[model samples]
Target: MPDCQHGLIADETETDDESIIGDEAHIVARSDDGPRGVSDLTPEDRDKYDNLVLLCRKHHKIVDDQPGFYTVEKLKEIKALHEAWVKESLHLDKEKEKDDLNYASYIDTIAKTFDFDSWDGWTSSLVSHGQPSIRYKKLKELQTIPNFIVSRFWPKRYEELEASIFNLKNVLNDLIKVFYKYADEGAIDKAKETDEDRTIRTRKFYKIDEWNPELYNKLSEKFDYHVSLVEDLALEMTRAANLVIEKIRKYISPKYREEEGKLLMTSGPHMDFSWKTFKVEYKTDEKKENHPYHGLKSFMTERAGRDLHYGEGVDTHYLPKRFEP
Candidate 1:
């Protein structure tokens, strides 16, 4: 039988007539003497594909000899299961091919939006103490990346990649918001006036016009905290980006290489930043506890203070330990 324990296949080239005679067993037998012959099925219906099951001679005789053991329902179930297995085996390759194309498309979209080739130049402004350095046009382009990422239909197999992409998006959005808040518009315009290249326009963090000792201390602390947060987010974003790149290389394309500096913003060996030494957790409800990018809204809106902690855990501890003059 198709689901026989012996796992035998009928060879049409065999010379034995008895071997092939009952090879095509019927669930509701065609004649009264045959197996499961008590059914009221019509002659044509008994010979139909639904009623027939392909089996070896041994199982055919066994089933026919003891029709009570292998009933019409049992044979029908066996036939259905066997056919399902065959169908899945035949289509496996086609499904894999389709998934490969989808993976390529998704990875390509991420890589293009990241614009890794110009990363170093665009991020060079951060070397000057986390200033609003990204070009206006470039920042605008970067802002659209999250939309593209969320719009894609990701497969279950790339869950980790999807997660990394979302994390990067969250950090990037925070950085952009911070830039917009503290950016010195006047400084940017003045810089554009001095520079011949219009593309060289850059923005800096706005400084306090008149410094009262107490006000200066408060604003300075907030400014420093914001700068630290920006730097930390940038590093976190880079880490997430590298994770996505690695996954793409491992799963989608082996030939893909990580871009130079891995899209990390670095001033020098001494100015490098990392999140490993400090613990940072975003606020989220129980349902979203497992999500890596949770509580992004709260993280952005939280007021900077002396403690620098937000939510349940210590969320922002990576303040730059610079020496005061």
Candidate 2:
């Protein structure tokens, strides 16, 4: 199967768009050692077993019609990449810090993508004639990122911010759903009814006055309501992200370790790409293998997502699930 984008599920309406994967033979092509082969082959043959890719109708047509665009090597590589991500062996290392710094990087990407710090701009986008066009762009950016959605990589150690994390995640999911729903239903409905031209009088089934004085007020009220739905959720995500990072800072030691990836963001009227970077650094804790994740029996335990530990034991210690130092 083709990989779904990280941190999200696909909108099911795509199915109705005639985007079905393999409804025809020509729509689904496979590669072999050479054209001479295929007199007979077993299911275990490496060519078929190891290289299968899924594509929608339009894409399959394009790939076949333009062989240069979808070379045999490229198609196989796509399948291989998707397969590699699915084989997650859970190679847990007891020696490492519990928080996945890489996962922190992923969260940081989300914070930046949503324009978390720029509320006024988001407000303008929300109420504009083209409402959601801005947010849709951001959503597409998030989806285009590869392999960033697997929650299993989350450091999974912080317990103090469990409630906050839960609330934030739940709200963000709500916002994403509403984001699409409004775009499809509200956008179309408004466009059809919103034009200023109003003149028609006939009664086959019925004819009605289009000069409704209440249309402006109705649309304005709905816009306000729509903006609030997203605004509240985005603010909550921003708050929860900061809270997770703050918790990590409280427990991080000043003594240094090895370097990890860094985050950089751009802003301002100049839009200088180097405007700012996520300065927080996570270093290796070689001096203390147990400096983090010290006592947890399993990284999968529940205490990581709660504020209280048993009366404190080998498995209970201060940690943040979203990120490490």
Candidate 3:
């Protein structure tokens, strides 16, 4: 048989220090670059081929013979097991939040920030069933009240929170559109179809028109159907971010705008990569200057006047007359 060590055995009678077979065999985990030995293999080891690797005498004996030493496979298995356990535990923890704060926290925070007292009842309803915000009392009330007339301003100021409702409405529209698209393309049938049939039908008969033409037409009349609710939600999210800054400016500090800008910047470009990490991106200057009210800049500027005020005795800060300090 060929020797496991250096190429050819020069002498049969050579001492342990010279004979290659007499040299210790190192055993290690297959994933590791360290030393390991043959005796380290367990009788019940599942991944025999994947769990062990070999090395030179000194390195092999150092790992195999030492009291605290480990084979490469054993170390790798231990590490993998630990990582799996951690992931499973984390998933369980997050699952627990699904029924409580995870679902309600965003709506709750927005309601409280806007001083809408009826958010509690809505939170209770959402925990039982994940319905749209349109079903919530606060949102329903805001919907009936026009943006300009809800509060005390002469021209009727629409707060970021109020405008966010518009965003929510837009989301509702998109979801409805998707619902209609599926309805048109046969979402209802798809819903009722067996998993196998649905898969087959989707591949065979699915199209962007016809599942629910009547419902699509109705939603279009209500919210301009072709416009995506996602776009509306994006605008509202930007508004929400700005409103937060406005509130901070009044009670915290006036320089809060700078901090808010940083926060907005860090959120990154908004794109619906997945439902898991979805966020709305800020609108660009062209969109802002040309269509501020319907886009990002309007969301930010709507709250701009909230932090500054004018009085009769004190010199009134006029936009065209004087620059804001």
| Best candidate (score: lDDT) | 1
For model 1, name the residue pairs that clash: none
Show where candidate 3 strays beyond 4 Å: 1-133, 144-151, 154-227, 230-237, 240-275, 284-291, 295-325
TM-score for every candidate vs. truth?
0.54, 0.34, 0.24
Report lDDT (CA) for all predictions: 0.59, 0.40, 0.35
Q: Residue by residue across 88-199, what tens digits does model 2's lDDT show?
A: 4333433234454544565566556544465345433332332333343454443433333334355545544333344445545544544554455443334433343321
lDDT of 1 at 34: 71
- Against the true structure, candidate 3 has what lDDT? 0.35
User: Residue 125 CA error for candidate 1 (Å)?
Assistant: 2.4
- List residue ranges in candidate 2 displaced over 4 A: 1-135, 143-150, 153-155, 161-166, 184-209, 251-325
Report, for all candidates in order, the number of backbone clashes. Answer: 0, 7, 17
Which sequence of candidate numbers ranks them by lDDT, best first?
1, 2, 3
Measured with C-alpha atoms, the lDDT of residue 63 in candidate 2 is 66
